[model samples]
Target: MIRAYAAHEPGGKLEPFEYEPGSLGDEEVDIKVEYCGICHSDLSMLKNDWGMTQYPFVPGHEVVGVVEAVGSKVKNLQIGQKVGLGWYSRSCMTCEFCMSGNHNLCQDAEGTIVGRYGGFAEKVRAHQGWVIPLPEGVNPVTAGPLFCGGITVFNPIVQFNIKPTDQVGVIGIGGLGHMALGFLRAWGCEITAFSTSPDKEAEAKALGATHFVNSRDPEALKALTNSFDVILSTVNADLDWPTYIKLLRPQGRLHLVGVIPNPLSVPIFPMILGQKSVSASPLGSPTTIAQMLNFAGRHHLEPIVEFFPLEQVNEALERLQSNKARYRIILKMDH
Candidate 1:
């Protein structure tokens, strides 16, 4: 049996719960969860905002734990090995995408918290493939968010082959944007932070931004026209899309890691004339995740986080829902 905190209905408080996990599959590995990060997606699932959340929901995907057990066919990881799991738990290894090292794009991928229990528990199970070993020297206490939020922003850097010399702009310096500022700064790019909150200018620069632009200022934005090589939007809220599009240089890319609720209204003429492009991506693949972890470990790049005990799960959720989290929230499990 796995002991966990779960909500029985939409917008319900998480309470102590237990369930029988049945038999472990041949390729499955059971993780003894140590710490789990609370992501915005978890809150969305808790409220059934996406219309796909299962009841008796356990919402955590940024998992840092140890391998308690592995099935007969598992080979790469051993019991007692420290590891992490992110948004995905399983993907069909036989798919072309998986074979090509892009398993995150597999058509039949399983989310850690989608139809199954996740890391907000004493134990959680995932296929061996999705279990990533922590690179040597990586701090596990604050490493949880790197698996989800960290990777969400890092994947695009790899996908787009963003260069160190590139001029990059990051929009919305909250959970995702803050991390982007850190990574892009370490990647050797000159980063400009775009946020409506002028108060965050000091924090943004402290996180790696070389310049801060109040996104609400029209003059500030217009002055940077055709200046950026890449602009990463990390906020879900819709904004002045056409103006941002114009900020891109010729052949520049405007990439989105945030899930905007509405369709984008982009100016077609400018994009055609400037050869600018718009694109979006999900989390990185297992291989890319490993690379990201290694880079973070080398740079000591960890999310600015607040810690909460697993028993205080509801309070942590409330903090996140109220937009009071400094950057990320992690739930420490009592062993």
Candidate 2:
């Protein structure tokens, strides 16, 4: 039996719940969850905003825990080993993408909280492959968000072979953008933050942004025409697509990690003339996640997190929903 907090209905409060998970599989491992980060996606699932959430939903994916048990076929992991799990809990290992080390792109990937329970609990289970071991210098208390939000921003850096010399701009500066600033700054890029909040400017610079642009300022944005090598949009809110497109240098990319609800109305002429591109990616593969963890550890990069007890999870969710989280929120499980 595992103890957890679950929502019984859409937009419902999470309440105490328990379940018996019978017969753990050979390739699987049972994780005794220590801390779980509350991502915006978790709140979205809780509210059924995506219309894919299941009731009795246990919403957590940014998980840090220990291996309490491993199946017969599981190797490279042992009891009491500390590890973390991200948005994806499983991927069919036989796919070409998986074989090529792109497990996150696997067609039959399973989300930790989509069809089953997740880490808003005392214990969770997942295939050994998706359970990443923490690097030596990383703090367990603050590492949870790296599994989801961290990777969402970090994967692009790996996939695109982003250069330290590149002039990069990050949008939103909330959960995802803040982390992106840290990573890009450590990566040696000339970092610029595009945010509407004047109050966040100082903090953005503190987080590694060398320059701050009030995204609402037309003059501020207009001055930067064809200036950036890459602009990573981390906000879910819609923006002036053509304006941002024009900000890119030739061959530049506007990559999106945010889950915007509406269709993007882009001005194709600017992209065509500049030979620019727009792209997006999902959460990263296990291999990429491991690399990201190592990079984070080496650079002493970690998410700025606000802590909440598991019992106060509903409040934590509310905080995230209200955009009141400092950067990221984590639920510390009780022993």
Per-residue accuracy of model 1 over 139-177 as CA lDDT, tens digit each: 999999999999999999999999999999999999999
TM-score of each: 0.99, 0.99
Task: Give the lDDT of residue 226 in candidate 1.
Answer: 94
lDDT of 1: 0.96
The CA lDDT of each predicted structure is 0.96, 0.95
For 1-335, candidate 2 gives per-residue lDDT tens digits of 89999999999999999999899999999999999999989988988999999889999999999999999999989999999999999999999999999999999999999999999999999999999999898999999999999999999999999999999999989999999999999999998999999888999999999999999999999999989999999999989989999999999999999999898889888899989999999989999999999999999999999999999998888888888999999999989
Q: What is the Cα-based lDDT of residue 26 in candidate 2?
A: 97
Candidate 1 regions off by >4 Å? none
